[model samples]
Target: MAASSWPVKIYNSSSITTDSLKVPLHAFIRAYDAPTPSIVVRADTQVFLDSLAFQDDGKVLGFDLDHDGYDRLRNTEVRYLIDVYMPTRSLASLRAMGSGDVVVTPSALQNTSVVLTTAGSGTVFVSAPSIELANLNISVSGSGGFQWDVPATKVTSGVDLSVSGSGTLALSTTTLDAGSLKMAVAGSGKAYVGASSLVNVSSSVATSVAGSGQVNLYAAGTCRDHKVSISGSGDAFVSAMNCRDTSAVIAGSGSAYIQSTTTLATSVAGSGRIYVAGTVPGGLPGSYTPMASPPVTTYNAVPVPAYEPHKTKFGSHVSTGTSWTRDNATLIGVLVAVLIVLLVAFGVYRCRKSGRACFRSKTERPVGYARKTSTENQAPSMA
Candidate 1:
């Protein structure tokens, strides 16, 4: 489908080279090659423009978010889109802080180490298949979703994923070939990992509410070691069929599932249980539905709604507003001419009846009437 085109406001035009960029507003960032780095922001109101900031240096570019300033534009029809142009190298990291959905383009990353952080009530879509990072770190700490679907991503060192608050970090279908993988979840958050072969995998979940913090690990191949810790009502599901060794500790009513072929070292407290896969009473938790990755977005201009022109309290006038026109002046002149003709005709009629000349002169007069002297024309003395 063709992308819509909306009006754009270039907030930051001067290009600066930067490897790390931060977007703190509701904007879409697309990466393109250019001589220097630039940021293009499109917004309906000046509020977003007023709160925009850029770094003078060429290393790090930051956009500061003003809470009160952004809130004033919350209920209005304010849309934001940002275009980012970098050098030939890829953007190394990104930090987004907003409640506005932002979609990152795939060509935005070509680095060995990339770190992405998201906060606020917005969702960030990262679906770059060509991304190959040595170290990948993702952290989410708000009521939002961080959808990372880089299945072909290869991690040489480690991979870290964490979720707090009522957020989710979904990477279920993503395959990672890493040395070690670490996952953590707290509060009412959730985490999902793909079935990948790893040397070491560690996961921990702490939750106070029922069906809260949950972690699901799907390792189809060989795993050197797997470790898990659960507390409160949290649960962990590990599907490593050929794991060499496993260690797990559960407290409260939590549960852990390890399908290892070698040794198992576990500690349980209260009603916690350690079971194998498909051995549960009924089935896995009904609430453990996999989170699907959001569709990739094409950075096209969004359509803006049409609105009527502004009107004044005096009402709208199609003609030349409150000023008079040449047509009005011509009409007024015609009326004055007709009025003068009528007054002259009336004076002639009155003169015939009174038997006097309407225009007074010193010598000229009517044929039957005598000429009026200066004394007669003037009024008598007041005395």
Candidate 2:
């Protein structure tokens, strides 16, 4: 049964392995009750779209509703909600397009690829935490921006980023292990990437067109085989302590801070400066203070013991450990005291109810004989 008022359109790719399933951008996507354009892609038992406003070509699932239809629904009380569900661990891909603010949530895109492109004034936010992404590509053509939080692991492929206009790209990743990384910026665009663990860079550059472009790459752990460039007042910052075979080029009034432990090379022209990690020759440029190295990560390897219930002498299950005994000792003593008091009270009640003496006083008479009075004692002498 479908979960909404409308019927769901099902798409299955269980038998296909040649390429990942694709969801092309179409309608003004929404997440049920939200007012912005958004969607959620996560693992499910079945593959279906919680909407009736889409097209399925057995290869591509795309939204077909136009902006006019979206606007009409937005003005009225009707809601335009869409959610995409995929089979568990299945290969999938999504492309985010068009001219509005968009948000992709949960980042449960395991074994998935994503492409983001926008040319409007609104920003696109892709939240991917602790996922294994195969590939990610992002581009911005106007003043719109992109913010992606991808703490990716086991990524066997590369990441590509481009910004051709004045927009910004805030891309972050935690690379347990990954392949190459490439980025480019033009026309006053800015790109910022913070990568942890091992980071590999083929090329990263900032080229100025109408204004200066800037690319700042902050990497922790080992950075290997990096090629960075800056042209026409553009700037670059690469902060990695253990860099191997890194090359930097500055063409105009740009500056860079690159630290390499194995092989470091730089070429500068037109009043640009390059800062190395440590001491340099007398004719070389100034040195920079590198960021502190990331703390070493360690994991506990010991297996935890399973829990077992403790059996008491009466064959009743009780909690184990000294703390449990300590906590219940006073309560058990109180309960025993209460039981003794209740037994004494019950015996007294039974003696009174049956017209018998439960306890004797010193002045009381015996059970079968009366006590002698003072007159009986005097009469016994007379007799």
Candidate 3:
């Protein structure tokens, strides 16, 4: 229906013609209510507003009797309705449907017995509910998707459905084509999807499976955690990487407990613990293999020798060694010390050639640059 609040003018009985009838919002509005600005529907009937009241015998006149009251009713569309022609389009709530294909709506409450049944190949979507469908068989054919707004309270076999929430969906029967099903949990919600045969899932964050048949989980990922509890006759195969940002735990407790039918190969950082109560007829796979039978009875014993203490060789060869990593800094320090000693020795050798006085007393004074002295003795002129 076009969800709006307009002045509703529909037909009423002859008994309620002259009498006043209060109008309700959206659907029900009666005659002689008011003669204000209304959606006048007097085309078929002879209903008209002569005075402040309606002058009709069958049709309803939805105008205000008081001028101010009509203006107030226009603002607040109470006791008014627009024509409803809401064809099913948006997938909302769903109830127990017939054995045929159905559409979706929001008001499909749980008490309304919400379910989507398909007799043919068309798709059907429904809201999640924990109710009963005593003798209802819903068949969704190949290559079709059925989405439930909420997680199912209870479900039946041959039903391929997807739920989007963190609510628990109790599985009454196995969800066939579980790989075809798409599910997303809020944080770390749990799902117990089991089956009699193989359940092939395409994309799911976290889900648990426990049934007599194989459970194949594929393309499952999420930022939160998820887990699967297995208690069935067949092996559970999680083909997808059951990787979560938080902790994800998978457990198995059964006679034929096969935690991984496939290889669990990853380089991520996590811990996995295994516990086994009793030994099974079949041996544990991979790392949990059993010990070999037919224990060795005896062997020729060798005499033990003593007194062996060899020196450790650390360089090039085992037998012979070299000074590859000897004291380099010590050698450099020795060389520097030798250079300093040589420099000191050279300085001493040059200094010993003259008296230990000022450099001015080392050589004969220069003739031109000689200092003036009153006691200067001039040498005789040489020939």
Candidate 4:
């Protein structure tokens, strides 16, 4: 279909590919289950489609913005709202080849896998309620930023997130129960993974920050077998309730703070600092460097008043004045001793009052008794 023939308006056109797309500045790209898979690019202003192709068993869609036999729309200040529709039983894959901001929400996708790459100041937002994918791979090598609002059940399989060329990436999720999660930041970029509950990495998690980049990860629950590497003045901070058998390597003046792990192994070099909490099996190895401790303050103590003892009308001795300390163990021992003495004295008094010995000799019997043999008292037996 031509760009003008669509149900939307059109502006000036430039000669590029034979197809033209007219879409508004702000539009909605929706995907729904249909009898046949089709793509409709509706724009407020007319735009040309340089190239569009479907490959990979009709499961992939690739589009390029071209004008005047040249790909100028990608580098120009033009934005379009893209909507994709797929079949009920088909899984679609999207590849964005332009340098623009791409925002993906859960409502905009069903069963899909995404691969996004841009070399401009682009921004990609993945804010979804629930996202289930085979894999997720995102690479941004510009001064752009990528923000991912992970849902409660996020990332079924593996996730590869990378940001270079001073780009920034942020991920927020309640739980990341994936097979594996790998994140890397280089060229002065920054990356953050914030988990509200626990970042349950079923397989492994590896993070690297180099070239003055920074990476911070926080998990409220246990993280199993995580590895972190920082070099070239980069800083990495990781904190979890308990981390089992974790490792960290810091080189070239980089720093790492791993807090509250059941077991940790650290290797540091070049004036790097590795701060670990909990237990380190054989202590830190290699050029082990400890973090600096905070300063302590001193305070003056107050004097306590002396204690005074008095006897009440009920004949119970108690402390009459303030400032008294009671030794619990000593008090308990004394009470037990007094209880034993009282019990013995009461027994003796009872024996004296009753005029009977409290204990009898071993040879004495309780009452009068006489021993009789069988022959002494014999009864007449029938012959």
Model 2, stretches more than 4 Å misplaced? 1-56, 67-79, 89-92, 105-119, 174-176, 196-211, 280-383
Query: How does each model score on TM-score?
Result: 0.62, 0.52, 0.22, 0.58
- Candidate 1 structure quality by residue, lDDT tens digits, 1-383: 11125444454435455677766544455676665566765554566557555654566666553444445545454445566555555677777664545567757764677787776555667766546567788877666667766656666767788776666666633455665677777655666665444323332222121234666555453456667776555666554433666566654556565644455566654445555532322333321112112111111112221211111121122121122443344335434543543454455557646877544322322222221111111111110
Residue 121 lDDT, candidate 4, scale 0-100: 46
> TM-score winner among the candidates?
1
Whole-model lDDT values for every prediction: 0.52, 0.45, 0.26, 0.48
TM-score ranking, best first: 1, 4, 2, 3
- 353 in model 4: Cα distance from truth in Å? 95
What is the C-alpha lDDT profile of model 4 across 113-184, one tens digit per residue?
Answer: 555443444455566666677676766555655666765655677778776656666666777667777888
Backbone clashes in each candidate structure, one number apiece? 1, 0, 17, 7
Ranking by lDDT: 1, 4, 2, 3
Model 3 CA deviation exceeding 4 Å by range: 1-91, 103-205, 213-216, 220-222, 234-236, 244-383
Candidate 3 structure quality by residue, lDDT tens digits, 310-362? 11111221100111222233234434543543454345446545645212222
Candidate 1 residue runs with Cα over 4 Å from true position: 1-7, 11-17, 55-57, 64-68, 71-75, 195-211, 219-221, 278-383
